[model samples]
Structures are given as C-alpha cells and as structure tokens.
Target: LRIIKTVPCLSRADLADSFVLQASKEKKCPDTDYLSENGICCDQCPKGYKLIEQCHAPGQRSNCTPCPTDQYMENRNFYPNCRSCKRCKRNEIPVTPCQPTQNTICQCVKDYYKFDIDGDTYECRKCKQCGVDEKEKQSCTPESNTVCECKEKYYRFKNKCEPCERQGSSFFKSTMGNSLPVCLTLFLWESKVSIFYTVIRRHATGQWSKQTVNYCTHFYLSLSAPHSHLSIPPAALSDLLYTVLDLVPIQKVKQLVRSLGVTDTEIAQAEMDNRYCREAHYQMLRVWAERKSLAGVGGQGELFDCSLMQELLDKLRKMDLGLAVQELETKYGTL
Candidate 1:
C-alpha cells in the first residue's frame, strides 16, 4: 500500500511551489482600444486626434484632442501629440492641396525642374537645357516637364538629334522631289511620329530622317504593323497623322476645351483621364493665371475667363488637327 500526502501552502516560500499555481491571465485589447505597456486597455483616439491621457485601468477610455492646423494625425494613436504637417518651399507650389489624411505635394515652381523621377526625392531639380536635336515642344513650368522634339530635318537617333537622309539618294541627290514618292515620304512621316511627339524612324528605313512631308496627301498608310506602310484612305491618313498629344501641358489645353464646347474637344477630354497629365494641366493653369494677371477665386472653373479662352483653343486645336483631305489633294498630291 502506498500513502500519498498533499502539502498546503502556509508561507510565502510554500506558495511558490504550490501544487495548484494561479496567475491572472493577460487580457487582449479589443480592436477599438490600445493595449498599453502598463497592461491597461485604453480606447483609441479618432483620426486627426492624439491621446493626452491614458485609462486608469482596463475597460476605461483615454482622453484625446483634435490636432491643430498644420499638424495632423493620420491614424488612431496613443501618441501625446500630432505629427507636424508638410510645407512647400517658397519656390515650390502645391500640386495636391494638403488634407488631413495626406501631406501637401510640392512641385518645383515655373522655370524649374525636379531632376529625379523617383517619387521619394523631394527636391525640384533645375530645368535641363534642350538637347542638340531637340526643340522646346513645351516650355518648363514648376509643375510641367520640359518637352523637347526634334527640329525639322533632324531626327531623334537614340534620343540624340541626327540629320535625316532620304533613302536611295545622297544629301544633294535627295530632293523632296519625285525621286522619293511624296506619298512615301508622308507615309514615313506618319509612320514614324510617336505618340504625338515624333521621335521614331521608319521601321522599314532602319534610319531616322526628318524632312517636310505631305502628310495630308490622299494616301493611305497601313498601320496594322509597327512599320508596314500601304496606301490608305484620306480619312485614315488624317487620323494617322494626328494624335491626342500626351506631352502637352493639359491645363492650358483644358482652357481651350472649355471654350470649344467640352464634348467637341475629344482630345482634351481623353487627356483629363490621365492622372499625371491632368495634374500638370492644373499646375500650368496657375502659372498662366499669374502671368496674365487673371483673378481666380478657387477651383478649376475660375482658372480663366470664358471670353478670353478662344485664342488658346484655336492654337491647341490646330496641333491636334491635320490638314484635311481636300486641301492636301488640291495642293499636294494623291497616292
């Protein structure tokens, strides 16, 4: 027979080795509360607020206060204070006006550029000078990128300007005459123009050439492939030569659209959908307003007066439109 005896705790030392050890389990804070280091469960402060007082014990609330202007709390926090808001430099402008949830986005002011494309880099870089083969397609502004396109007769060769040479002919031998089919030259022009900003060579030529071509001549160019050129209808030719230029600063473009009856301005409407381009449009608008000494209370609608918007609309419209078929045929040639 075996006799088993159980011992009872009578002193502090005995309690340490007691058969039935008891400990209060740690409590988990609910989603609405923060589990503090002191083991107190304190309710979370709302957004834009910071906790100033902690709960005395579990199942209690904390004291919070609204963050002051130029300061913000993005999330519910037990922090003693809100974070300081971001500010734009004197030379920089706010592209996105600051909000409680997001910081003010700064863009370099007019005639300036941000050298880096990296989003995290905050400094606006100096606007670079135009390349040798490049012309100012659009001037640099604080918010708009400097756009450059090759000058006439110069072609973009690996982004550098190289003189265009007519095929099967020398510089002197090559004439915009009958030797190079005017239609063929036009085909090359339409085929090589890239995304409204011309910078490509004929897929067939394998070399870059920039010479004035009869882009409107009643000729068709097959665009089904990257470099295939075939005779196309006059309408197709016009469509091929014209594109909704993506490089243009959109805000000034928008001014024209508003004056032209918004829907008739198809190109402008399409551009508004692009986030980067759309913001650039607004940025340029502010610069324009300042230049013209225009009064603007707030919002995009007040950017410019309706009566003064016609001239800009006409200029932008011409860039988006190519020569009509009848005009090309009457003056130029037919395929």
Candidate 2:
C-alpha cells in the first residue's frame, strides 16, 4: 500500500479547483461548484425571513426561509419565504403570537362560555351568579349548576316552596309535611327571640293566662323538642323549681351518688329514665349558679354558662335560649 502526500505551496482556490477537477476526471464527469452556483449556501436567512425549512443544497429552492413573526403563508410557492398569519377574531385572545415557524392561536373572553364536545378547544369560560330580583333559582360550581327556591310567602309561584306565613289564613306556619322548612324556621325564631315561661294556654278561647301560650309553647318546642311535649305534672315542676332555687352544689350530688357506691352508668340510666337527657333544667340551673357565683375571669358569657345550652343549641340555627325566653316574656308576659 502506498500513501501519497498532497502537493505543498498551492493557493487555496487553486487547490480546491484542482481537487474538484480530479474528482470530476476520476468520475468521468465535469466539475461544477453546486453550492456557490445555485445560491442556496448562505450563512443564515436574510432579515424578514426565517429558516423554517432546512436547505437541501447551496443553490436549490428547497433550502431555507419562512415568514417572520406575526405572519404565515396560506399556500406554498416557488419562492422559499412565507407570508404572515391572520389575526384572531373579536372577543378572542390569542393563545400565542404568530411566528415564522409556527401557527397563530386564540381564545374566547371570560364570562362567555362555548361548549365543545369534540374537545377541540378555542376559547375561555364564563362566570355564574344569581339574577336580579330572583333569589337564587339554582346555582352551579365552575359555572351554573344550582337550584334555588323563591321567598314568596303567599303566592305559589311556580317553583318556590311555601313559607310558614303562607300556611295559615292569617299567618304562615309550619305543617307536618314540610319538616325541613319548619325545622329551619323554628331554629331561626328560637335563636332570635325570647319566650315566656309561665304562659298557659286557654284551650277554650285560643287565648292565654299571662302570655300567649302558642308562642311560648312554640319557643319551648323549638329549643327542646321531644322532651318539651312531656307534660310536667305539677309535682315534677314543683320539684324542679325547688331543686334550682336551692342552688345545691354539683359536687354534693356526686358525693351522694358516690356514697351509695352505685355505678355512674346506673345513675345516668336513672336520669335518662326520668327524661333528664343529661340536661335537666335542674342541671343547667346548677351550672348557672356555679358560674355566677364563681365569676370566672375568661368564661363565655352568661347564656353559655351552662354547657348543655351550647351542646343543645349548636345544631339549630340560633344558639340563644335565655334571650329568646326573655324576649317572649317582655313582649307577651304581664310582668
């Protein structure tokens, strides 16, 4: 095998030409400078044009050039460069600006929604809220999906529920079938107003002894249902009253029970059998007396002094009992 060194001291152009000529001769063809002759081999695309399509050769049209930013070519042509892209439609924001190498993009305005089943997305979504004069008819999350009932009291307007005031000839009231509404209303009234404790109904005339009995009963029932219906015989009421006014210490009750050595569960069951529900008015009175006497520095105010008050009222709309009773006393009780 023989190795040959290239001839030294030849000019760069002359050496290139000699190599081309030799290659042409060896291949039995004429030498042609394809890159320089055809005008395809430039260092970069000129200003206003981008190199989106790659070059095939120095002079060929297949090589180089596309439209600059914010432009596009609708159709292909003999020339290598492209035209600008179109602008987005009204109420639509562009997803991306037009570029020489890519397509234009856009979207719709917020507060205006357009559904698309095929998933070809092109717009923004809208917001949802209740209309004027219409209490929430229905609502939806992410948009419009709720169903609302009206507050119309007397008239049975299409979809609205009947209010208490609409239940009777003179006033709306809760009936058996509409438990939720009745419950909700009862909860609200009891929370906001007071009731009279001494009122006894004149069953004959639908009147009262010292105060309106229906209102008092309603108030009591709302605050303490199931138990409220229990007819507190004179004996029971008298015993409860005596127990409260005496202001006996709770620790004494515990001590008495402990002295008997009876299990706590048994005592609790006995209280339940008496319909005490762990919150007999007597128990609440004991707590109230204790708190009032001690005057703890950082206690939740008077009404909540009795733990049962909070425990029982939390589930209802209103959490006030003493105030409700007081208000009723002020409004209807003779004194």
On TM-score, the candidate that comes out on top is: 1
Cα RMSD for predicted model 2: 25.0
lDDT of each structure? Answer: 0.48, 0.37
Q: Which stretches of candidate 1 lie over 4 Å from their true place?
A: 1-26, 95-102, 117-119, 126-144, 156-335
276-320 in candidate 2: lDDT tens per residue? 433443443344333432353244222212222222222111211
lDDT of candidate 1 over 245-282, digit per residue (tens):
23233333664444434443444545555467654444
Per-residue lDDT of 264 in model 2: 64
Model 2 weakest 10-residue run by lDDT: 313-322
Model 1: weakest 10-residue lDDT segment is: 191-200
Error of 1 at 323 (Å): 36
